[model samples]
Structure formats: C-alpha cells, structure tokens
Target: MRTSWSPAALDAALENVHRAGMPGLFAEVREGDRVWRGAAGVADTATGRPVTADMRHRVGSVTKTFTAAAVLRQVESGRIDLDAPIGRYLPELVPGERGDAITVRMLVNHTSGLAEYLPYAYPSLKAFPDLANTGPQSLEDHRFTRFDPVELIGMGVTAPAVGTPGGTPGVYSNTNYLLLGRLLERVTGTTAEECITRDVIERAGLRDTGFPTGPYVEGPHSLLYEAWFGMIDPPRDHSVQDMSWVGPTASLISTVADLNRFYGMLLAGEIVGPSSLAQMRRTVPVVSQEGKLIDYGLGLYPMEAPPGRDVFWGHGGTVWGGGTLAAIRADGKRRMAVAVNMQRWNRLDSAGRPRARPLDDALAAFHRVAMYG
Candidate 1:
C-alpha cells in the first residue's frame, strides 16, 4: 500500500538538512497525479535567496543513466551490439587485447576494470594514496579547464587495470563511461550531447534538463558550495565551472521535478524497451572501499528501501559542489528527487576514506521522509 506524503513532515526534514550544513536543498515527491515539493536554506549565501523546486542543479554521474539509455536505443536499432567488444567500435582509441576483451555491457555495468583518470590528471592529489577520496583542492587549478574525452580516456588506459575485464567485481570508474560516451558517438555518428538530448531528454519530455555547453547554468539555480574540509576553505562558491572534464559521464544539469519524471518514466519502461530495461536491472555485487556491497546494474543502482518500505531503483550522483538522488519504487507508485547544493558532505579520514558527518545524517533524514514518511 502506498502512503500519502505528509508535507509538514517533509518541510521539517528539509529544515533539518539546512541546519545540518547544506547551503540549500530542493526535493520533489510524486505519486501518480499528486506531487509534493519542498525546499530549505538559502540558494545564494550572499543574497540569501531560498532554493525552489524548479531550480536547476548539476546531477553529476546520474548522466550515466541517460548515456546508458542512448546506447541501449542504438542496440535496439541494431546499430550497436551489447556483447560486442568496445574495441570493435573504437579500435584506434581502445587498443590492445584488454580493449578487445571489454564489451559494451562491461562498460555500462562498470565491469570494464578501467582505472579512473582524475586522480592522476590532477597534480595536487598525485600523492594522495586513495584517489577515490580526492578533494576539491586537487581540482582547484583545473576547475575551469576544458578537457577532451579522448585525452581523458588516454590517461585512464595508461593506468593499470583494476581487474580483468568482466571477470572481477565492479570497480566504479568514470573512465568507463567516458569511453562509453565515445562509443555512443562512434555508433551513432553524432555527438554524445545531441544523442542524449534527442534520445533521452526529449523523449522523456524533460524541459529543464540539459547538457550545458559552457560553465554557466542558464536558468534559476542554486549556488553550489564546496566545503573541501578546509583544504581550500569551507563553503566556497563553485557554482560555475567548465564541466567538460567529466563530459557525458557526470556533466548533466537538471531539476528535481524533471529528474523525478525521468526516473518515473524510465522504470515504467517508457525510455527503453522491456528487454533493454531488464538488462539494465541485471545486478552485480560491487564492493566499495568501505567494504559495503552495493548492487549496480547498467546505469542504475537498486537501493533497498528501509524496513517496511518498497525497494527503489535509480541512481545517486555527486559532483564537485552539488549532489543529487533520484529514485522510484519498483511498482512506480512513488518517486522522489532530491538535490543538495553542497558537496563533500563527509570528512576524509587519515586513510582518505569518507567518514560519517552531520551531512550524512541529514541525507538519511531526507531519504526517510521521501521513502517512508
């Protein structure tokens, strides 16, 4: 049975998130024709503008879902084969036997065993033992720099593989999606941005979601603050930066409402066909550095709901200075989209692993309200 959303409870939860350290938060909950929106804290610290549900924010790696969908669309059209090795499409770029062994499916499921390039590309974090926990200081010099996807993939391919392609547990790598983006272009003979826009965004009727060609977000949006654990300074405004560094993988901007609609339609089999959707939901156990097991599919993550709540399927994304969480119940009866205009919520321990902080509690509270309230 589905429960009606309690606006009062949701409002209180948003307030707690603001008090817990987020500069601002905007969220939407939808069940059939009924929708509820809420916000708290200041969108701009200088002017103290309140965040609104319609405000656009960077959705980060959630862009992968769209990319995956575009690829699947090509597969359905017979332009691309899921099991074919990526080297078949981009042999010049993804050379060697390892490339030949890695299939399109492996890339989407993060089983390609590719190393991420960000840590090695940035000079500041070169000595940081764990690149996964690299902080904002590492990116300060290149925040506005434009990066070519080919160059990014070159850096990653030069690094050692995490494991044998398709033979080991998935290790999350931004490089895999970067390559996938290139593969999409190779197969479609169109830019990744154009393909995603037409195939996913337009098809889903998401008016507020887009791939920005420049650093500025071109609509009402919250100021993104990065608290890099005092590495550069706390609550530094990083709302604008050239996102080309993570192109096609983590560079899409969207609003809570649009995100909810996208996920709702996606899980309902509106975006991709039944066969492709089933392939997307096929799960593999991915063990994180913290030793937690997460079930990851093609581009989606299946998050088990709290006790007594229905399981939700979707994705969560975090960029330099913002975060997004979008999910819908398996039955498609309930959906939620939440965006926080702050990043690096958890403090890094001496080993460079994230440890719990106030922001974690705020996120948990927001999820509880969105999923179970």
Candidate 2:
C-alpha cells in the first residue's frame, strides 16, 4: 500500500525545503479539521525575520483568481458578456487583430494560443521574454523591469498564433490572464487593484489580502531568495515595490491565511453568487502534460492529482522570484494554500527540469491531514 504522509511530515518536508534550499519561506496548511501554519525559514535570510500570516508575498499569476472574480462580478452584473467580443468594450482589443481571436472566454482559459514565456524551452515557451536583456540582469530588477499594462498587451500581440482561433488548444500563455487583467481594468472605471480590494477582498472579509500599493508595506513581509538564480554571487537587489508594476498580470500580493479565507469564502458563496463563481470556474479544452485532454478552467485550472480519489481544484502562480499553489477539494470541506518565495519553475533535475505543482506543498500536506498528520 502507498504510505500516506502527515501534516507534521509535510511540515518537516517544508522545513527540509527551507533548510536545504528555500531559506526564506512560509507555509500555511488548513485541512479538514486542523490547521498548521509555520514559517520554515527567515523572511529575510539576510536580516533574519519570521514570516507571519500578515506577511505579504507577491502571488504572481495567482492574482488571476482576483482578476477572474472581478470579471465574473461584471458578468454577474450584466456589465460584461462572456461571449461578447472583448472588443465591444475595448475596441483596440478586437479579436484576430493581434493574432488573438480570443473572446473573454479564451483569454481566461489560457486557450488563446498565444506564446508562453518558454522562449527558449522544451518546445513552445513564448510567454513573453526579453531578448534584449537576458544577460547579467539582476533577478529582481530583470522581472519588475518597468512597463505599463499596455506594453504587456503588446507582448500578446507578437505571440505566435498556435491554433486557428482557439482550434488546437494546449499552451499555457501568461498573456491570456494578462489580457483579462487589462480588460477588467478597462470595463471597470477603477483599476483591477481597487476593484479586487473592494469587491473581492473586503467583501470576502479577507483582512490579509490586499495590493502592494508601493514599496513593500512598512511591516513584516516574506523576503524571498531566488534559489534558482539569485541565491549567490550577485543577489537581485530591489524592493517588492519594484515588482508590483506587473499589475493585474502578476502583482496583488497577499498572505496564505488571507488566501485561504478568500478561497473559502469564494467556495461558500459568501463573496460571489453561484453562477458568477461557476462562470469563473468554467472549464475549457487543453492538452494535458500526458498529451491528453485536460480542463483549463476559466481563471482556474482543475486537475486530478495522483493518490487522491477526487480532484483538487485551484490555481497556481509563478513570478521571477516566487511561486504559489492554492487548492481546495471538491467537497469544499478541505482547503489548503502555500506560498513560497522560491520560484524555480525552470529548475531541472537529473531526470529533466523538475516542475513542482505547488501551493508550497500545501495540498500534499493537506492530503496528509486526512490519512496521517
């Protein structure tokens, strides 16, 4: 029989990850009946700080959940139409013009056939990479390198069209979520930042979730180390504020506790109606890692992990510096979230590049809560 791990086991594993590699990491695990939240390493390995639930970390693409929620809210309010050409609202964004024959649906589902950031990757990783400054760039500054949302939009414009108007699907392009973020900003008079705060955060009663307006909040925050690149030699020197410019595409930092509370409220209909939430979770077609069909849900990615009887639904995020994995069981009784400052999505092991489906081991530990720890 397969051995099951425990919450304690998961904690130990996280601590192992902390000691061996992730020096500045905090993990939060909320299971069916118990909760274990701990700071594995230092928030700032350099200065020595502990990570707290209030500690903020850039959520990266996980911010899509917030952007999705806002868009669905608009859909719920009749302010936007899912099938309505994204151009009806933003004419400059008309489909098929910029190699994107995407409707709002395609944009959210990552099926727009746009390039992902694997410019020099396994095959197709055109998710936006800077060819000009790939050499000796500070990890932090290299990513937060300033550019408006419109510039990000332009990145989508150049992404090679993979399929004929969403015909052959199966590429995870960050541009789709990026476009959704921009569309949300345009449809609403307020920016995605303000709307997410007012509509999603406050409404969901998520005290720990909020946007990083400027430099890191003058309080405790997770000081991440780029284990893959910025771990030694010359460290990426820049504040969290520098990375916030990614805006709806990436920005929107929050805590694990807040993320758990937010997703919990979302599943429980506390923040959004059933239809609106359903709209956000709308699943679409995509090629799986196995080269089979998979469900790339709207604003959310759902998959059935091994060793589990049921599917875990949620989203993950990746930035230049950090990565996050947040998931909730189908029953809504189990919710887990883990955010790590170490983003080595491109890390390669002996077998190949090791790709960890994360919530910082949140779900793995969460799975243990039922069987062992």
Candidate 3:
C-alpha cells in the first residue's frame, strides 16, 4: 500500500527549509498518476513574490544526466563509442597520453580522474572563504567572463589527475563533463546544448527546459541568491551571470515538473536502449572529500533512502545560490524534484569541516516525504 502524502507534512518540510535560511523552496512529487507540487516562502526576498511550482531555476550539475543521455543516444546510433578513448575524437582538444588513456566511459562515470577547473579558475573562492561573501573582486570579474571549453579543459588537464583513468573510488570532476560536452559537439557537428536539447530534452517531451544562451533565465523564475556567509552585508543576487564557464556541465535551466518528466522517461528506458540504460546504471564508489561514500552510476547517483524508504536514482545540482535534487524510485513508480533558491548554506568551519546546517535537515525531510508519502 502507498503511504498517503500529507500536504501539511510537505508544507512543514518546506517551512524547515525557509527556517534553515533559504529564501524559498519548491518541490514536485509523483506516484503512479498522482502528482503533488508545493512551494514555501518568497521567490524574491525584496519583492516578496511567492515561488510557484512552474518557476524555472538553474538545475546546475543535474545537466550532466542530460549530457550523458545525449552521448548515449549517439552511442546507440553508432556515432560514438563508450569505450573509445576521448583522444580519438578530439585529438587537438585532449592531446597527449592522458587523453589517449581517458575513455568516454571514464568521463561519463567520472572515473577519468581529471582535476576540477572551477577551483583553479576561480581561486579566490577556494583560497579565501571570506572573499566569497565580502564582494570579492574575483567573483564579479569572472561572473560574466565567457570562458571557452578548451581553456577550461586546459585548466583541468594541467592540474594533477585525481587518480589514473578508470581508477577505483571515482572522484567527481566537472571537468570530465565539460570534455564530454566538447566530445558531443565534435561527434554531432552541433553545439553540445543543441545536441542535448534535440536528443534528450525534446525526446523526453520536456517543454519547459532548455539550455540558456545568456545569463538571464527566461519566463517565470525565482531570484537566485548566493549566501556568502556574511562576507557581504547581505547575500548577493547571482541570478544573472553567464554560465559558459561550466558549459553543459551545469548550465541547464529547468522546472521541477520538467525535471520529473525527464527522469521518469529516462528511468523507464524511453531515452536509450535497455543496454545503454544498464551502462548508465553501472555502479562505482564515489568518496566525498569528507569521506562519505555514495554509489554513482554513469550519469546518475543511486541515493540510498532512509530506513523503510525505497532507493532513489537521479542527481543533485547546485549553482551559485540555487540547488536542486531530482530522483526516481528504483521501481520507477515515483519521482521527485526539489529546488531551493539559496546556496552555500553547507559552509565549512574553521577546521575545514562542514558545519551542521539546517538545509541538510530540510533536504532529508523532503526526501522522506517524497518517498514515503
């Protein structure tokens, strides 16, 4: 028997999100044919506009799932080879023995061991935590910078590899996906965004999702705020900024309803053949910097639910201030997408350890409600 989803319970969970210091939170849950969407707090803190279920937000790294799916579509068409070395397609871009050693499979599963470029490109955010909030010049200077994917990959490859290619205990790197995006372009003779939209978004029938060509979110959306943790007098509005730095790795704009639909179709094998989906679900251990272990699949993360709840398969994404979690049950009978308009609440303490934060609690609560309800 399915547990009854309580609107009151969901509302309370969202209130906890707001109480945890986010400006707003929105979510959508689906079980069988039933759907539930809820919103809490203000979309714009200054105007007090309410967040709605339809509002678009930067779904961030969750875009990897779409990118991976698109690449897999090419795999099904014989246009790409999952086991082939990335160097085969983009010899000029990848270059050297490292490139030859890194296979498409390694990139998709984040086993390529490529170091992330963001910390190196935006060093201020990594070096000085205070600058993240104190109106650091680097933040503003780089916010609108249009970084080429090649340059970003250069930044990553130049850094030390996290481990050998196809190594165990995969280290998550945005750089791997950035290269995959470039690989898609090389193979399809189209922009990565175009390929993803045509092959994944369009195929999934996601009318509300698209790759934004500019910094601004079109249509209805909430104000995205980056909470710098008192570096500035108040949290900065980062809703507008070019996302090219991250490219297909984290630049997709979508709504909760669209996210749910995409995952639903994906988990049901409508986007790829059963064999490709099996490849996508191939498991690897992803160890966090803090030593937490999460079982990561090719494009998805299989999140173990709390006791008595079903396991969830999907991905979570975070941009400057916005955060999103999208998942479907193992049986594909239920799915959910949760969005919060604030980011960086999971701050590190003086010892460089993550401090206990309420946003974590809010997420856990929402997951329980989404699963059991």
Candidate 4:
C-alpha cells in the first residue's frame, strides 16, 4: 500500500546508509509533481567535504540503456534489424559461424553467450566465477590504461563461451555491451559515444549526463572509494581513471537528478518511439554479475518489488568505487535515482561467496522508502 512519506524518513534512511559504511550518498525521489532530494555524509572523506544532492557520478553499466536506445533508434530508422545476426553487420569483429548464431536481440538482452572480458582484460581477476576473494591489483594497474574496444572484445570473444547462443539463463557480460557499442559505431558511421550523446542523452534533454571525455568528472562530484571486499582497509579512491576499459558500456557520467530525468523521459516514450521502447522492456532471465538471477531486457531490468507494490523499471550501475541506481515506476508516475561513493562492502565467505553486510541492508531500507513511498 502507498503510504505517506515525510522528509525525515528519507533523510534518516540516507543517514543510516552513510553510518552503515558509505563514505557518501545522494539521491532524488519524485512522486507526481512532488520531488525530494537528500544527501548525507562527505564527498571527500579526507577533507570531510559534504556531498550534495546534485553531483556527477560515474554510473557504470547504466550507459547500456542509452546505448540500447540508440540502437533501437537505428531500428526505427530501418537501418538495423533486431533479429538480424550481428555478424551480418560487423562480421570482421564477430567473424565466422559464431557471428551468424548471435542476433542483435540476443546481444541486447545478454543472451548472446559472450563471456565477460573483465577476467582476461584484468588478469588479476582471472580467479572468477568467484570475485569475492579477488584482489584489486588489476583495477589499480589499469587505472590510467587506455584499452581499445576491439582488443577488449577479442578477449571475451576468444574466452570460452559461458553459454550457448540465444540460450536461457544467459550469463551477464560486459562483452555483449562492448559489442553493442561497436554495433552502434558500425551503423552510425561515427563514434558510439557521439551517437549516444546526440541521439539519447541530448534527446532526453538531460544536461548532466554524458560520456566522459577525460579521466576526471568535469563538475562537482564525490570521490569514489573502492573497498574490494575489505582488501583495501581504507577504501582507495578511484574517482579519476581512464574509463576506456569499459568504454560506451559503463563509462557514462551522470547525476541522480539527470538519471531520474533520463529514465522518466525514456519510460514516457519521449526518447524512443513506443515500438522501440516496447522492445527494450522485453525481459529474459539472465545471471547478473552479482551471481543472482535477474530479468534483464535490452538495457533495462525490472526492480523486484513486493507483490502489491508497483514494479519499477530501469537499471543499476557500479564502477570500481561508485554505484548508482535509477528507476521509474511502471506507471511512470514515480521515480528515484541514488548514488553512493563506496563499493564492494560485502565480505567473502569460505566458499568465496559474498556475505551481506549492514550497509547492504541499509541501502535496501533507503530504496524501499525512496521508491515505494
């Protein structure tokens, strides 16, 4: 049931998250014409600079939604076919029979069976499918490294297939999205970043969202801290890093307000035509990078809610240290976007599984109040 929400409730929840472990947190929540924004804790732990409700964040993976929309826009223009094999367009990248087997639709929904290149790209993380015990060496080494998308794609493509083409329970991989970015560039005859910025970000009228052109965020932003499941005792800051490793797949910088606005426009059918939006919302079961089953669409996913609560649709993103989540209610009447400064709080168990920490519960509590109220 929908209940009345006081500003105090939201503020308290946010503070709870900070007190739990986050170095900083900021969020925006809108219900109908009423909007609430809250911030708690510091943007810089060393200086104790306060975080604000409006600040740029490296919202990893959320870039996929924009990329997916751009491709769907191409679909609207009849320049691309959803069911067409990717090999048909970029055969040189995904050559041979394997390319013919993976469809654009499969890539969008992550059913293409491509393994994540993260392990291969960051050799220190090769110990996966269990990342809980992984060290931070690879991330540290590549902080300033500029990775070519093709080289990264090759790592994932040549890696053993995690699943079959068009398979169910598909594995979540950044490789699929990197390939999508290439597809966008192939069809648009321009950079993927430019196409998304012009077609999706600008079209949504989001002033604070864009692909980062440099190693640093240009505006007011918090320092992103990475804990690496407590491997780094003080949680090293990773706010300034060359984002080329993920490229168009996870390197977009944005704010909570911009995220809310972008998702609101997207769900309202203002960014893409209704047919394209429909295709973007078609979900398939996929194993997330977190090792949980999620209903993933093109670039969007359904936020699991209680039986009686309204379902929210959008996406969650995490870079090395920063994390973000933005969603609009299924009815498009309510929306929430949240950003946090620290990541990898869960401790690893003997089995190499992540054990939930207090911060996880605290963040969920804030989300319940932010989105459901």
Candidate 5:
C-alpha cells in the first residue's frame, strides 16, 4: 500500500487498451520490500466505477492455487492420498472405464485425459444453473451452479474421449479438478468454500476476498459489461451467473491485497508445511507442443526447461467474462496475480467493430507495468 505507481503513465497505457476492447485491469507486483500497484480505466464502464486495488476480481484460473492448497492440507492431515486413484475417494464419480486409473496427482497435473467439456466457462449465461448449496459469508456463494459434478461428468462421459482411457503423460482437463473438488468434499466432509476459507482465507484473515453472490450485485461491485444481442453498446453486468461455475479448477474472486496475503502466506508455509508444498509443486511431463513437450506441475504452468521444454509455472484460466494468471517465482519466492472483470459494455471494439476476448489488451498492459517494469 506504500509504493508509488506512475498513475499518469498507467492511465495512458490503458486508454489505448480500452480502444482494443479490454474492459478493466488491476495488478500488484512485489520484489523484496518494493511493491507496486496499478489500476487503469473504469471497472464498470456503464456505472463509471474506477478500478482500485481493493475491488474484487474474478481470477479465473488462479483459483487453482486455492484448490491445490486445500487438497494439500488434506494430504498433510492424512485425509487423502495424493497417488491413489481419485475414484477411491469418490466412487460415484469414477468413470466405469478409466476411473481407477486416474489419480489425484494426475488431476493436479492436468494429465487426467479428461478433455474440457465446457472450458470451465459459461459457454454463455444461458447454460449456468439456478443453484443450490451453502457458501461462506465473505462470498455470495453457490455450491451447485446448474449441474452438479455428477451431471457434468455424465456430459463429459458421453462425449468422445480425449487421450486414451487413462490420462497418462499430457492431457489437460478441468474435469480432473472438478472431481478433485468432489474428492475433497468426500474426504473433509465439507464444501470447497468451507475448506478454502478455513484452511486459507479465514486463516489469513482476508477481509475483502470471497466469492460474490446475489447481494454482491448491489454493493461496491465492478460492473461487468458484455455486448449483448449484437449491439455496440456498453458492457453488460455478469452478476446473474452463480460463482460456482468457477469450479474447483478456477473460480476465485479476491482483492489485490488479499491475493498478496494468500500467496505470501503460501510461500511462508503458513497454510501448509514443507512436505505438502512439495506435493503441490511437483511437476509431470507432457508432449503435445507440435515438435515439443513440457512439464506442468500441480496448479501451475511451465516455466523454462529442456528443448521443447516449458518451465513456465503459473496458472492461467479464463471464465465467462473474467481472465487471470498467477504464479510464484521458480523458487516460490516472488508471487504475482492479476484479476479483472472483462465486463463488456459496448459490443464494438470502441469503433463499431465486434469484440473478441475483450480483456486481452488490458491483461497485456497491466502485466507490462507489474511484471516487466
């Protein structure tokens, strides 16, 4: 909260960003004791709410860190086995064919061969469920957003298989994490929100961080705009869909400050001990990069590696109108995460042209300041 950011410079960079269809951008950077924060453009263009470090953002894939951490807690407590077939924990979720072959380790590594049935996204608001389930108070919660994990798995099962039955070396599937959530629920006898808050959020005393629900729409919310009905209008609000769509794989909403606390604690072994951290950071190799292959650790991307090797170790995720990427340094020292509500107000790209991936430019611009500079 003490670092000085070049506000004028960030604002100017974002102006061109808006022209490119990016809605809202916010970021934080930490190197040793120095911390830099930036917020460019309006969070809710229609409502004219200026972006701030405290505003909550839907950190699409970064949510994986939370889930992975929670699971490691279970492992630390001896509540679950990392190498056992996930079906051992939740038999009902086990696919008849390859269920026993898929292990918790595979799920974390995205090697479970379960092709993404829905990209862990809304596919559009119409597909979101009405909802049923309890949630922590910090978040307007939804446990069952539309279809339960069972139903979604059924849909995934009916579709063509991705890799061979057993997701071996390299297959990224959100379904694995969905099953992981179910497994966590079975092992802990609690919902993901309960575990996430108890093990991490609440423990860290994160105030403004949580999954927003109905009441969220009425308060200091970032207005999300989407070009609806093919109109070149302002972004539309996304308060309608339940936060559950984020799934265990990637649905987390938090302030820049809360994210800082979470990652900081993570590295300090506040939430988990050293052994559990190792379990979560372990990487598995994959070979699908055209003429290359690489390793993806639990909840993280590649960083740097051998030929066709990818050592990028961050987690990247996109959902509905939200996108995010977060990761710690190779040594798990310096950590960075970004969140923004890509609420589309105008259907056009600030010039009557249709928009695609509206927040792309904002993401790039914010990273330039927080990561590069």
Candidate 6:
C-alpha cells in the first residue's frame, strides 16, 4: 500500500471533475482492504436529482473486457483458438481472404484493420471521422433504432481496410467486436449476451452488471446527457435509448462498485486462467476511437500514466451521453472505477481535432490520485 489512502483527497478529486463541467459522476476506489465510494453533481438537470455511487450506468465499450474474457474462457475449454482466423468460426460473416487474414487475436487486440462501422451505420455521425463536422441529428434519428449485428458487420467489412492485418497502430473498430460476438454465438449456440453473462459476468458475480435487455436501463440510474461538442446546444437526455447498435461491444450497464469488483477478480486470475490473463496484459499499439494511439490488449488497455507512476490495466467506454472507466493497478492492489453521466465536452478545432479542455486534466488528476493514493 502507499501508506496514504486519503478518502478526502479522493472525494476532492471526484468533485474536481464535476466542477470541470461533468453533469454527474460516481466512483469507487479501493486500496488493499479499504474501499471508498463517492458521487458528485446531479443525475438529472431538469429534476435536480443528485447522483449516487450505487446507480447503474451504461458502461459503453467496457463490455469489451467482459467479451474478451468470455472468449478466453472458450479458449480454455478448447472451443475456440485465439490465433485462428475468425473466418473459421463465422465464415459467412467474415468471408474469404479478409477473414483468413484476420485472426481472433487481431480482432481482440484491434489489429485486424477493420474500419469502424459507426460512420456507416449512423451516417449523421459521419462527423466522427471528420471531427469538425457536426451531426447529432442521427443520434435522435436512431435513438430507438435496433440495428442487426450482422448488418453492422457488413458495413464495416465492406468498408475499406484501415491498415494491413496484424499491423501496428491498429485502428479501433466496433466491427471487430461485433464479429467476435457472432463467433461466440456460433460456438456457444446462444446469444453473445448470454454467453458472456454466463461465462464472465456471472462467474465474477457482478450483480449490477449485465447486458441491457432493451432501451431502458433497469434499477436505479442517472439520466445520461450528451453534449456532442456543442452540436446539441443544451445537450439531450439519452438515458432510455436502445443500445442494440453497439450490442455486445458497448451495451453493458453497470455500477462503479461492480466494475471495481470485476477488474479485481479479473486481475486475480479468478475470471480467466493465468495464461489468458498474461495474454491480455500483453500490449500493442492501437489507435483508440478518440484517434490517439494507446497500448491496447485483448479487450483491455492501460490507462494513460505519468512517467514513474504504476500502470493500470482496464478499459474505458462511452456511448452517447455516458462514459465509464474501470482500472486496476498492474499489481492488482489499487483499483478505481468511475462513471460519468455526461460526455463529449471538447469543442472541435478547424481540422476536426478536439481541443484540450480543463475537464480532461481534471479527470486525469482524479485518476492519478484515485489509483496511486
């Protein structure tokens, strides 16, 4: 332990993020046997409902970690091969040379060179590839839309490859995870949600974490507000929107405590075997959806760390108005899981790049104290 676990310091850090324009947020920080949970701001601006640490939240692509863990469980059972091409399991979905060229490991690590399907599926969000463009119109247009995973896979597969398979600086794409979802179904003869829930979520005993059954998040939760970088003037509440568009990739709803628990067990070799965990810790360069190169592993990535600070392994995810980050120190002792009700704060520059904001530094400082202290 650091010999200095300050609950007041952690609370102040969480408060700083809220002061930096976060609508609402909650977090859980653990140090050895001690645990601290905190929340700040309002859950609903209209109603002024205060946020709480126990609220369930739409945890975005953090679902990838659970999905990757499920795949590794299958690997342990001899039902799947990590190095084998995805085509072997879902040929009809990822056919021919492209499928043969991309392996399960590549897909898990985001090195498969698949272009993101978001720009294709939500054409309005084309502003994504070109950050200077504004397109929150499609967000509301498809709020209730239920997209088929196979159709989304087609959009990404048919799109031009971002790079060669097994290449460095891999582009992060939800399409690769969508295919992994289908592969899970093809092998387990069940929905990807069911397989992951049974194999990883249930195995880890995450009571507040599971795939959303529909447009509504069950149990108590905060209203999610999306800023869209000022595209939507006042920001809009997307708390009840359907999440099928991201499905097994980013649709899981959970809480801060559950997230911390999941990572703790995951790092302790309780959720996956030692070999599988080692493979997950193996890092490679991959371009994150945010357009920055990050050290990504199989469904996991190290949160950005300052020089001389200990590295933390986990994942961060965002969907519309919500975002969550769950990370555990490499030594598996310190951990922090945070969920925010607001997202997309940075204003785009002339070249479509997001300008740095005080909020960014505020959040980073919070992570530093939460994980290291």
RMSD (Cα, Å) of model 5: 7.4
lDDT of 5: 0.60
Candidate 1 on 270-316: residue-level lDDT in tens?
99998999999998876543346688899998887767767889888
Per-residue lDDT for 114-153 in model 5, tens only?
Answer: 6665522333222112111211121112323554666666
Per-prediction TM-score to the true structure, in the order listed: 0.95, 0.80, 0.94, 0.98, 0.76, 0.98
Put the candidates in TM-score order, highest first.
4, 6, 1, 3, 2, 5
Local accuracy of candidate 6 as per-residue lDDT tens digits, 1-373 = 3536999999999999999989899999988899999999999999899999999999999999999999999999999999999888888988999889999999999999988998888996872447776678888999999998889999999999999999999989999999999989988999999999999999999888888888998999999999898777788999989898999999999999999999999999999999999999898999887778899999999887777877889999999899999999989998899999988888788888778899999998888888886
User: What do the candidate models score in CA lDDT, each in turn?
Assistant: 0.85, 0.62, 0.84, 0.90, 0.60, 0.91
Clashes of 5: 25
RMSD for all candidates, in order, please: 1.9, 4.9, 2.3, 1.1, 7.4, 1.2
Q: How close is candidate 5 to the true structure, as a TM-score?
A: 0.76
Evaluate model 4: give its lDDT: 0.90
Over 166-258, each residue of candidate 4 has an lDDT whose tens digit, in order, gives 999998899998998899888889999999999999998888888887789999999999988888788999998999999989999998998
Between prediction 1 and prediction 3, which has the larger TM-score? 1
C-alpha lDDT (0 to 100) for residue 148 of candidate 1: 85
Stretch of 10 with least lDDT, candidate 2: 122-131
Better candidate number, 3 or 5, judged by lDDT? 3
C-alpha RMSD between model 1 and the true structure? 1.9
